[model samples]
Target: MRNVLVPLSCAALFSLGPTVASAAPEDGRPVADPSSSVAASGAAARLAPLTLSVAIERAMSAHPRLRAAVLDVEASDGAVQQAALPPNPSLAFEQEDTRRDTRTVTVLLSQPLEVGGQRAARTALARQGREVARADLDALRAEVRADVVQAFFSALIAQERVSAATESLRIAGSGADMTARRVAAGKLSPIDETRARVALATARVELRQAEAERVAARHALALATGQEEAAFVTLDGGADSLPGLPDEADLARRLSDAPTLRRSRLEVDRAQAAYELERARRFPDVTVSLGAKRSQELGRSQAVIGVSMPLPVFDRNQGAQREALKRRQAAEAMAEAQAYRLRAEVLSAAVELRARVDEIDALRRDVLPGAREAHAAAMRGFELGKFGFLDVLDAQRTWLQARMQWLDALMKAHRANAELERRLGAPTQQP
Candidate 1:
């Protein structure tokens, strides 16, 4: 288990592998977090990679948070029907005794009629709450999707690192073999062969550690995908390759629709509906009663009707109305804050993404080719007795490190894009 939070709501913090650190900004709150890329290299290719959407869909379907949100919405929907129902009627029976054989018998029925638009207001409030719950469900889906995609990329990086470590081990073994041949032929010292063997041993240790990390990363991905047993599923994803960058200008336009911001706005709307309902409650309802009165001895019957109402002098519902108004105001303020944070996040991620793209390009075009050529030349020179064993070792180490850096850069670029999408409250591109 890893102490890292990701997706929009810190959902994956508990299950990220040992290598994952929760340093990325969540939503629009600017935490000075580092990028979530790991140190790794390109190596063994995955046998069958799962697509990003398949991973996300599997995770979302299994996540209880999204299901809970749906249930909340359904409950809110039920409230609407409850709100629309009218007050039930009441019935009463009465008997009065008089002197002698005279007696009076009465039967009455009363119905309370709702006034001041209270019923309509209550229904509106319930409907608004449903909207808010539905919006929250939408946000939940987006967050889960981001988490799965990022985890897939992390696992992919781990596998590549394992391959790179294996490659390094192979190089070390080759150096040791060459040194032994030279020592036998009286060309190199026995101590040189011992040094080569030591390097090979170190490479073997590194390869084992790298393989362990890959296993951990894969397990973490399985957890994020909500596989109950952490099954060994080879995740195949295009997340390693950089997707086309979104237009920065278009991101601003998309802000209004961002899931977090949308939920905030819905909160405001729901609060306003509640406030209106409270205000509508200031007036009292009217209850009308009808009865038949009978005098047994006099053999007479009479029809009677009466109306009743509550006086507002005792309580005008002023306190509740004021509270509702304040709540609505608070919701509006929160919505504004979320908007500001979301806009800032988009700008920040965009700048970071561009810089990473340039770095990756430079490493691919100018750095890697030269490092490879240098290592190759050193190897050839050593075989021809023009270079020392140390020279060859140094060249190989430099090339290995350069490749690792390149891989790190690539992973960082992918993370920047995923963070941007998470903050956007929706997927910017199909994974």
Candidate 2:
């Protein structure tokens, strides 16, 4: 059996079939490097076509959502830096007795010391927060990659549909021309010629609709790639370029390390660290002061030292500690729930991918060949005056329907594969 599809005779179905490509990368980065080629179309300039890799790379490099996620990571880094800093020291000056000989001045410098491990706990929490932000960035990157892949395939499908419609229009026009000639020669009824014209008109309308859909799909692909306008009019790829699906066992093996689950786990760690930091706050920090005092009356200088600390009276961070603990619990629950949901989704996508692959195989191997043969036979019989024009129309419709269904199956298969890769956290090798 052919892996892609067989071309029909006059209809030329699957002649320009859609393609699928890998959206996930092995190293968890964007699929391909960005290229500076393929600029937006000018008034008379023809833009170069884009490959799937270029489109994905452009999205990863320029997509606003990804930039926002990177900013979150940078913000978390700032928080970590702030958390590591020691408390600022205070300098105080006092003056008393404005009389000439009774004037006294004292200079005091005090520094708060973190004796309760609050700095360590705070810094740990901030680092964990940064990890959570990084995880979020990774998750967002994976999502963007999948979105680009889906949009790319959608455009490819639209392109193929326009080709199919154009072929149908040609076939319909040929049938109409043949019927009109036969009617003029008095070998066919006037109604047969009318029916042929109606089919031709319908084909024209279908072609127009398909062309519109292709335009919409191109716009969607541009948006997905973070472009302000559709930059390229064509895509570079071939049919059946998609990687094969891994078995259920492989998907199960990759489930635990999914990006979403990793983010959720990081959230739990951050919440636990926050709880520790809050508990550390229950012990008040101490301030130590050291300075020199000068007396105008005595005409001498003396050194002074003192220490102070809060008694933790009435506010031992009880509320904050409780909140942090509750949040930690919530994070744990959420992580568990996410793991469960991800497992289910991966399995579902695997099943869907398998089914679509099988359906596509059946259609190519068993259905399309028969439909093409039937349509060709009906056309021949109609020309020989052994069959009605309606018989030819029915066969043509059946063939068109089969082709559309095959396209639909291919679209679904591409989607399922993209979803499966996204959930797997990384690209799997074809088996």
Candidate 3:
């Protein structure tokens, strides 16, 4: 993925005019030639086109949320390291005086050792926690990518709508011109011209609406890409042709990689590890220390060792272990529920996608052309004085309505395509 940024290097090189060598100074300081440099630097500040993929990559690299998530991973890694380390050593010093003159001093060092695999258990728990955090970061990245994809598609759809509206306006204008010519030739009533003008006005309104939608879509794309408005550009690719629905077996395989499902599974693993850690705590950890001591009366040094262990007389971690177990059970249930929901969503989206594609095909092939032919016939009849202005107006209205329906069908097909891609965890194409 290329980072979305203007090529300042190119701009600088292109913006600089012919560079002139500076004349040497006689007084030990050279005069600066800043004309070319200033021009180059100014040009480097101009906006450049950025594509959707590039924008997404740049945002992923620079986004504050992703950076924060990365920091959390590092913090969790540090926690794991701390858990793996042994307890700090202990040190002691003693001094004694005997027989009014003799004195002895001793210094001792001791290290406390963890017992009952406490270090290993704690490290395991920390490792699991780190995994959970990493999974969370992955989920966030996927969400960001999905948003960028959707925004890019929406912008493309808006552009297409604008194009369609522009064409409709042209058609309406042509209709108005034809009506005027017929009225001047005394072949049609003035009421027909009025109707045609009304249609043209409606077309202009639709064009304005389409333009507004395109502007809004561009803004959304800018937000998703973390780019300035001037840097926004059209996506490079068109909508991908709808693919055949996946078989049940294939869909099952693909579902494993779904971010939601994967996150839920990781949560289950984390909960299970937490439960085990709690259980391990039921066996108390022992701390042992060894040291050396000196006696002033005997003028001798002796080694001393001590061991301490927390007795599970009162709190055996039973309550904590039970709570952890319950949480683990809940996590498992949640994972199962997510899996079910994902399956349903994938299936539903697939069904809807197929229906939308079929409808678009039917509208394009059967309905729109028929309406256009009927409108042409009605226009010819009115010009020949075989029909009234009302008949021609009605036919034009029907044709316009059909064209709008066709545009709507296209939009639905695109929307369904987006939904299917989202459900399948597929990467979106350029448009």
lDDT of each: 0.82, 0.86, 0.75
What is the per-residue lDDT of model 2 for residues 1-431, given as tens digits with 9 covering 90 to 100?
A: 35344434423534433222235654667654344233322522335677788888889899999999999999999999999999999999998899869999999999999977999999999999899899988888888887778788888888889988998999999999999999999998999999999999999999999999988888888888897554676788653555587876777677878899998999999999999999999998999999999999999988989999999889999999999999999999999999889988988988898899899999999999999999999999988899988999999999999999988988898888889767775755321
Q: State the lDDT at 58 in candidate 3.
A: 66
Candidate 3 residue 340 Cα shift, in angstroms, is 1.1
Query: Which 10-residue window in model 3 sums to the lowest lDDT?
Result: 17-26
TM-score of candidate 1 against the unseen true structure: 0.81
Question: Relative to the unseen true structure, what is the C-alpha lDDT of residue 33 in candidate 2, on a scale of 0 to 100?
Answer: 39
* Residue pairs with backbone atoms closer than 3 Å in model 2 (clashes): none
Sorted on lDDT, highest at the top, how do the candidates line up? 2, 1, 3
* Rank ordering of all candidates by TM-score, starting from the highest: 2, 1, 3
Best by TM-score: 2
lDDT for 361 in candidate 1 is 87
Q: Estimate each model's TM-score.
A: 0.81, 0.86, 0.78
Candidate 2 lDDT for residue 128: 98
lDDT of 3 by residue, 227-314 (tens): 5666645556453343355567766777788777877888898898888888887887666667776666676888777778778899
Instruction: Report the Cα lDDT for candidate 2.
Output: 0.86
